[model samples]
Target chain A: MADATDSSDPVDALLATVDDGDVAFDGLRLEPVADGDDGRFALETPTLDRSTFGRSELRDVLETVEEYVTNWYYWQGDVGGEGTARRAFLRWCERAPVVGEAVTAPSAETTLEANRTARETANGTAPETTAEADQSLQVPQRQDALRDGIDREWGQLCITARFVDVDEPDGVRVYDLWHVDDADSDVADLEVYDDPRTAREIATTDEDGRYRPLKTAPTLPSGWAFTGLSGDELVETVGSVYPATIANWHRERLGELDVDHWLETAERQTGIYDVVDELPRDAVEWMADACCVDSQCLRRREWEYEEGDELDVDGGDGPFPCREPCSLVVAAARKWAILESETERTYELELTTSEFNQLGELIDAVAEGRTDEIREADLGDGANRYRARYLRAKRFDDDGLEARKRPEEY
Target chain B: MQALVVAAHGSHLNPDASDPTYAHADAIRETGAFDEVREAFWKEEPHFREVIRTLESEEVFVVPLFISEGYFTEQVIPRELRLEGWDPEQWDSDGTSATEVTLSVGDANKTVHYCGPVGTHDAMTDVIVGRAERVTEDPDVGEGFGLAVVGHGTERNENSAKAIEYHTDRIRERDRFDEVQALFMDEEPEVDDVTDFFESEDVVVVPLFVADGYHTQEDIPEDMGLTDDFRLGWDVPAAVDGHRIWYAGAVGTEDLMADVVLERAADAGAELGDAIEIVRAGAGGSVTEPADVDGTAGTTKTGD
Candidate 1:
């Protein structure tokens, strides 16, 4: 509900906020990147750009990052030290949802309407989409495949993380990526090696502070039903969580302009700061982060909201594979189905009391996540349907009768 | 004869962690089906490498006791087991026989079939809910007050947390609590955060951890901001902050483990022929001792 003719141009203000680390989950991504050839980036690319630290420290920073990746014991707990940039780059990727089959620039008026819809969605109310997101997704798949061609050229990207442990059974090695290489840099993207193994090694961490296997992650999957659903829904959900200001704006501005258009804009433009070129700093960034749209990040990110701060959460209604501790039980059920595919279908998981309890315990032990363990039980059915159980507590009298207390006295 | 190795990621830190598998192995014995039933570990005695070699049976059914399908259950265990020659499609689901060892039985009756991990059953939800309820003395703790399930969280993979949430949701669906929240030690909505997360003026916290470790006695309650006398029973006085807190033993401590383990064994055995003979792990002494297993204080508690 920005003023139709406010003196302070919202875009310029928004861009300034992006520069100050504002992230919007409900509107267009408003990132201020170094736009490269032909207007993809902004002008700050060539000349000295805005930064808190000097460029002279880039090598030292990069080396510090290497040392941390190579050894957690060294710099993991250290503050103000240069570290991995993978996080910074991934944040960039999170904003830059690979655009495909370029369309003519959306008119300023069209964008204005889109931004409004995004604002509405930011307020936790539902806005039905007539235009299919499925359409956008399809466009990307076709274009990416077509552009890459049948005999595709694979691009190498370097990624790194802190080392937890190393286990090699067959030839494959999997490294747990806690801190990625480009986590601290303003440069939004990373250039990593294509091969997963090489990626692990090159982006290695040390024993004390960090380490990454030279291995790379698997190529992005072709059909992303589960993953896409999880991440996209989160993005959309956090985008739509009730923002205090937007709600206020809507309540007051309902009779002023086109409410529907505003709602639509907000819905489509979620995380505009996280994903766009010139996002402004606003309360929405703070709010949607609590709403957490990217499901993959749920149960994974750990930062406490200050006292008196309301939490925006990734609702329990997030995508599969869920974050921990929910993932612990869910993965157990999934493992039952997948490993025993020959006999038990997905529906007939034979969760023993102990494993079931273990799974539940793992979930409860977690600190922050939207959904509880129970939701996962109801997910897959008919063999794909999973089963789980945990230990129930109580004291038995000499008579072996179960004792009970009233619901409120305890 | 084919054999199924029930591999548990055993912990030397907490003996209770491995209790269920040992109990389950006993249940499988009464039916006398498998040529071999054993517990191997990633940490405890008889490590994975050692356990594989102990499988005198050629065709071994390697079943991991992990609650996740992540890297470990899928990639690491399979790789360690050298299952390239074993077609999952061809392997037996019952602990019957294996072809890897000429001595290994391959019959649905005699073969060693590897069953899936005991993580995907609806029955487990019942056990978890039941345990959470039993742990408190405060009537307010069970059916209505906010229920928070705390688990150990690590940044290794998303599957770990997914597995935990799967259980909490199950309990929530029963309509037992005014609110049910899943929190993690390493993640958000932490044990301490639950008190704040709870809009319900007061809440009962349940530690869903697998053992009676530092997390249970210290981290969990500390997070809850409780002080002295904040013992884990119903209406326990808080030592730090005088919050009425109920301490529940690790949900895994339910004493009915023997029965459930037996049921699983029977199910696996039934898949094979009905006339399988039970071979006890310790030929002389009973593995199914039905002796007291201290489920509390991590001590001996008789299985009901």
Candidate 2:
């Protein structure tokens, strides 16, 4: 960990220590947001507002880190580019206590000890000491166990290289190892390495890197190669060997990416946002009456529509804190419209102007509850069908009027 | 005698909420027990109100296929069907009362027998126990596992919890499992606190809901930390927390429920003349109607 008392500029002070042979260090700081008046932590940044990110975003980042760290060797081999940066940051978070405590990295000895203890407990046998257990454990078994242990603990910390845009023969690329608990603080400082090979050599070298050293370096599996690869490329290349690791890495990335552009388009097309834009007063009032999808928006009554006012369809981008085109509203409207369109419906008869006028009269008669008077009118062909249509139209008109008249009824 | 309508609280968002009701209705219809066996839902078509208009039968028996005797069974069914003898004002002021009423509908004084919900029937305790027992790896060594009867309890009404407690007590009396407890989704002794209730490593949680809807399919499994990868109506045990959690489908969807519905219908004084034929054909010897056996009238098979 870099000494805090070095200088005022934490980034430059830390960066100054990086040499050609030493581990590479990136100046990026990941820290926890501080508490605010609203009893929530607000991210203090220039590019993003205090309200732009929340605990959810922090959780996503942590989840990403957790995945990469838990399966480090796989990520080291298979994933490349930005993935390497994320893995590196996570490793740094693990090694650097200022960032976060690393997840428990189980060792071969510990795993063997645990298995023996479990066996003893289940069999009701007397517990054996470490020395006794070690004496009975075979050499090949121990080696296999140790290999499994390190493999399990792979990516237990952020282990990746960072390339800084500097005028250097090796391109100023540095390997980093650090860990930061997402909940504790947002600020994370990395431990840097000069090159990928140097970083791996140090990592495997007992008492030097984040991991505990094995008695002997485990033999590499068939087809394993680390030559000619950058620190990031090495991690990705290693990660690619394990199918699950790469698959999970891809799965996590897919979740992070917003692929629901159709959902947004659907919301924009049919949402109350467009309705509000068209008839600001009536639509907003209708929404208020219809009840805004957000249960927390208590200012629904006070929401008055101005001509130039725009409802925040995204719930955060607008000037006003109106949750007008909420997810529920969009979903409900889309579903209702879809159901209406999908249902088998037809208008069989194309009436003449005279027939249309008569139909209107019939609808009015039904709306006015003049059924007794309409019963005495002259009967025409398809009279029953016309009457049914008239009743349906009247009911539709009544429903529309009712919706407008008393929005509270909904 | 004319028509049998299974009334349920359906969901507009989840169509599967009303699926079991429709399925049960179809099964019962195949028996030809009544003129028509139809499903009436509050959310879907044919709607509860619109259902009556379509029913050509003068006499109707509406058996609420809900798990407990709560708001939906007592209030919603009565209100929607416009059944006589239930005061709308009294229902609105006090909600559903404990007293079950048999109402008459239409000017012809057509009898509309409002039977007790299928869940509240005395035979249902056995159904719940059976659900839990099916998932038990060793049925003979019942002491190794715990049985949890989960219900959709409501804070608004104590009756919801009471029904669950009633079934739990009966299951406990049988003394088949090491422990039998009642848990709720919306009340104390919640589904989340299930581990605290059971010391046994293996626990079987049987949801006493009416359908394999959102609550059963998503919420309960999520709360219990069980993977809900299976489709709706899949009755299988999921492993969680080093224990096997046998999540049974809602009690209302069980094949044996056809018997319970007929029992409810019989209790309401409906002449179930061809019920034996329906049970024999539809349930395949699963349902034993009271009227089928001599001196077995009003006597249901109970858990020991």
Candidate 3:
């Protein structure tokens, strides 16, 4: 720790502000000692027991806090930056809120309740208040209460914040990032990554070791965590796992995201992808419904059919904006366009009601990529591998489904 | 004047998709021709749509390190970079390649010159011949060996096949190989018919692709009957039916690609001034002479 009087270092500059009385910030409390020459200070946090410290020891404690707060400001920018998604997320981590309505409104309610208790006491009768009302009066106490750990799900990532020392909030505060699927596993069990580039390697494959052509696909592999990351390191590691997501999320909050819709994007295609423009308008809506849903991609689709012409489908509920149709969507649209060109045909096949519903379940399982999740032992599920095999064995022939010939043959 | 941006298509599943672009950029950066050499990818970090915002450079040279001039080179890259006079309507109507496009970026109106892809350059024929010749140890120097340039051709884009045919014709004009044919992975006269395409005892197959991903690593070798079970970095020079087959790695990942990228930039009118001279001019406010940058050479292995 540098000299506490030094005005240049950020931590020192902040500590120098503690003068006569106690000061509180982000759950840490500091009080200046009466000893003038020693420049001692008393410190306390929700978890850390109250203790007296000389200048150097106090400086060491404040250094770690200053680093965490400084990095938070650097990556998160001003606390009041626009967009409520990240702001709500930060508040969930026990950090102070940008808008203090949630904090200040409760204090006002307690103040009103406190005045009622004063009036009851002045009536010369034993003052009585319900425990529920008394709980509201302890607003400041709630704010000072110790929190063991906090976790929130952002897209596929499970972000966690925990105190590093035994019951010492002033000690190092560490953050961990991992796949939400691995939330139940021990940190020691998961593969650990310190560098941001390792996140890229982990994001390259799925649970069954298949290449994930789309990073936003709902098939992220589990069993990995990036622990003990600083604020900027956490942000950088998350960005590597899902590139441009943080930037786009921030841009959406700032109201500066530029969205290129489907028609304009398709019109610009010059080669084989040019056929994507030939898709019927209704088919385009189907395409968005198929590929842009939250079950398929993590990004919320911001682009519409044109500019203000919205598709009749629900765009995902992701915090980040898609901005435009991705390459995967374009590639899928091209195939759909050619398939749409062929004349439609209806074939007659005999099936029971249960078998008919099974076909729908089979399509849903494959479309949502949940076929792998259904186990062969779970034969009750229509999409179970052995169940589907039995259905295929019963209905499908070498010629076609239910031994039906091609429509052209008729 | 400020930086060289090598833009290419990247993969989320396969890191090998962008390895060649990164290697080429690193090789070019070593020459000290520009103050910075950065890479932008369609599917990776620093995406093409926002790569310019990451740069403080006022003037940049954008080279598309792709294999062909098609959807990406003519349309996707130009639009993403927001070129000044790029009219996609015009490209779609005429089906003509945009050899060079210049876009003004940021408040400073930074000059961004978008150069054509390196794959279609005439210099690629030399790289292809070098790849074919290097695969064999025969003292005959690939004189009697038939050469097959394999490409991932799709029915959706004619340009993919045209790129392969262009190199095959150029290589045939030299009269070096006994036979030259354009084989595709998805089109007619596929790579599976390599043995039937040539009657020569020895045949050299070169994949005219940008990177050694699934296509080059597994699919092509499996199609050629070279290996029944293929993995990454499969062995070459296997014998089948008394015919010697020499399979080369993807042509685009060659180390000499640095020079090919520079040639494409030079064709787009880039002034390759030495970075040391530029720095001296910034400090002293004047320069007596500007050194000419030597082109990069030599073949080195790609990817870690």
Residues A1-410, candidate 3: write the lDDT tens digits: 22222444445445665763455443445788787779888776444567888988887886645533332322223332223333333443443322211222344544433333333322333223322111221213322331355576668999876555534343234678898888898888988888765776787778888767677877888888998776545655666566666656544433457788999989976566879999999999999988899888898999999988999898887756788888778778889999999876667788889999998999989987788789769988999888788888889888658644357576
**TM-score of every prediction relative to native:** 0.33, 0.39, 0.63
Tens digit of per-residue lDDT, candidate 2, span B147-265? 88898888877778777888788878988888999999998899977777888887878788776655665667668766443232223455666666666646666666777777777
Once fitted onto the true fold, the runs of candidate 2 whose alpha carbons sit more than 4 angstroms away are A1-410, B87-100, B106-109, B136-143, B228-236, B274-304
What is candidate 3's CA lDDT for residue B167? 87
What is the C-alpha lDDT profile of model 1 across A1-410, one tens digit per residue? Answer: 12121214233333344455433321223233444422121211111232332323432432422221221111111111111122112211222111111111234433333344333323433322222122111112222322321111111121221112222111111111112223343332333222222322222222332221111111221211111112222222111121011211222222211122111222222111112212222323333343333422222222223224333553332111111111122222233333433432222234456555655654543423323434655533211114322122222235542344343244
Model 2 per-residue lDDT tens digits across residues A1-410: 11321433322332232211121111111333444533222222112333423444644542422221212212222232222223432232122110111111145643343334223322343332222111222222322332322111232222333323222211223333332121122222223333333433332223322221111112112111222344444443333221113222322222221122222323334213233233323334444344442332221211234325434432221111221233333334444444444434333344557656766766655544355544434455223445556645654454332123233333
Give the best candidate by lDDT: 3
| Fraction of the true interface contacts (Cα pairs closer than 8 Å across chains) found in each model | 0.00, 0.00, 0.28
Task: Name the best candidate (by TM-score).
Answer: 3
Worst 10 residues of 2 chain B by lDDT: B295-304
After aligning candidate 2 to the native by TM-score, how far in Å is the CA of B196 from where it should be? 1.8
Model 2 chain A lowest lDDT segment of ten = A96-105
Could you report the DockQ of all the candidates, in the order they appear? 0.01, 0.01, 0.20
- Considering only chain B, what TM-score does candidate 1 achieve? 0.65
- Candidates sorted by TM-score, best first: 3, 2, 1
Question: Candidate 3 has which clashing residue pairs, if any?
Answer: none
**CA lDDT of each prediction against the hidden true structure:** 0.36, 0.46, 0.66
